[model samples]
Target: MKKNLSISARLTLVMILLLAVIYPLLIAAVGKLTPGKGKGETISVNGKVVGYERIGQKFTADIYFQGRPSAVDYNAAGSAGSNKGPSNPGYLQLVQNRIDSFLAHNPGVTKEQIPSDLVTASGSGLDPHISPDAARIQIKRVASSRGISMQKVTELVQAHIVQPVFGPAYVHVLKLNVALDEIKH
Candidate 1:
């Protein structure tokens, strides 16, 4: 009976050890296999790596389209929202500040034309894509800065807009940057 109990105990210990080793390996493998914007390799242009899908960085040049506001400033490990409800006073203030900044940068734009994504933080605070409308709104500014026709800038935006892979949605920010690089060349 004692021998049988010892055997059972040994088996349990081995199983536990196996699980401990296998669990991490399984997790690592699954992480590698998972498909998402953040995990994929970033595309570069003109020997310059401008952005990453997982990190939100400022694209402030009038010649380039901008993306959404970030809460954690696009820190991947610190990804999170402001947690301020829409009605929160802090949220309102933050939005107002963004509007102010936008107006200061885009003197020719009307308040009605500014894209919502330009002032709003995405839920994850790490969103790399901006809405198509946001890209469109910046076309005039980009065109004026680059001395290109607005029509040409618009064409670039349309060409760069990533169509929905599985549904009717699109992303415009990264493509806009790539288009900007192309125009420069």
Candidate 2:
């Protein structure tokens, strides 16, 4: 009976050790095989790397398009919404502040033309894309800055508007930036 009990204990210990070693190796192998968003490559301009799909950076220049609003100050590890419900007083205040800033920078734009994505932070603070309307709204400013015709800039924006890979939605910011870089050259 003692020998039988020792055998059972040894079997359990071996199983535990096997799991401890194999489980992590399996997980690591799967992680390596998985294709993570923004892990493939970054879009470069004139051999200068600009940004990654996972990060949201501020684009203040008039010659470039802007991305969606960020809540965690564009920190990837801290990605999250402001958690303010639509009715929250803080939400309204923040929206108003964002609107004010947008107007300040885009002095030529009217209130009705501002895109909703520009004034509201995305659920994930690291959104690297903006709505097509947002890109369109910035065309005048970008054209003026680059001294290009509005028609040319508009055509470029339309060309960069990426239709949803699977459906009807689209992403416009990355393509817009790439086009803007081309215009610079």
Candidate 3:
């Protein structure tokens, strides 16, 4: 029993060193090789950092296209999903509320036309990208609110679409909004 206890203690110490210390350092080193160099990628406008690249934020104004509803209220430090399954009553009600709110904001937008992404919070509440279709649906409202033509807003959304090598195309909400601001109305 003494020998077993000694072995367990040694194993625990080794795992703690590997997981707590070495793993974090290795991840940080790898992050340094990425775009933000261990920090998140920032989207800047006029030399001012407006927001991070892959972090979702609230955009409630009618002139701007809204992203997915966040379960964690877009709190980066508390990123999480609703954790309630689709069949759960409270979850259903929440989604229904989102649907109602979206329809209210987006006039002429039918419930069937609303994309699932727009009404449901993503698994990671920080999902910055939405499907191109989701952005397209909001074009009418944004164009009208901004006093721009729908064609122009459509073009802007098209320009922001990021086609990955594996998955379907997506638009980064923060980048799109920044670009929208840059457009001369």
| TM-score leader | 3
- Model 1: per-residue lDDT, tens digit, 1-185? 99999999999999987898888777777878676422665556666766665556667677778888888876676778767788999789989999988888777888898778779888888887887777777777788888988888888778877776686444557656776667766
Error of 1 at 181 (Å): 1.7
Worst 10 residues of 1 by lDDT: 35-44
TM-score of every candidate: 0.75, 0.75, 0.85
TM-score for candidate 3, residues paired by index = 0.85
**Residue 45, candidate 3: alpha-carbon lDDT:** 85
Candidate 2: tens digits of C-alpha lDDT, residues 69-176: 777877666779877798989799989998888787777888799878889988888777777788888888888878989999889888877786686444557656
lDDT of each: 0.76, 0.77, 0.89
Each prediction's total of clashing residue pairs, residues at least 3 apart in sequence or on different chains, is 0, 0, 0
Worst 10 residues of 2 by lDDT: 34-43
What are the runs in model 2 whose C-alpha is more than 4 Å off? 1-40, 46-48, 165-168
Model 2, residue 18: distance off in Å is 7.4
Worst 10 residues of 3 by lDDT: 176-185
List candidate 3 stretches off by more than 4 Å. Answer: 1-23
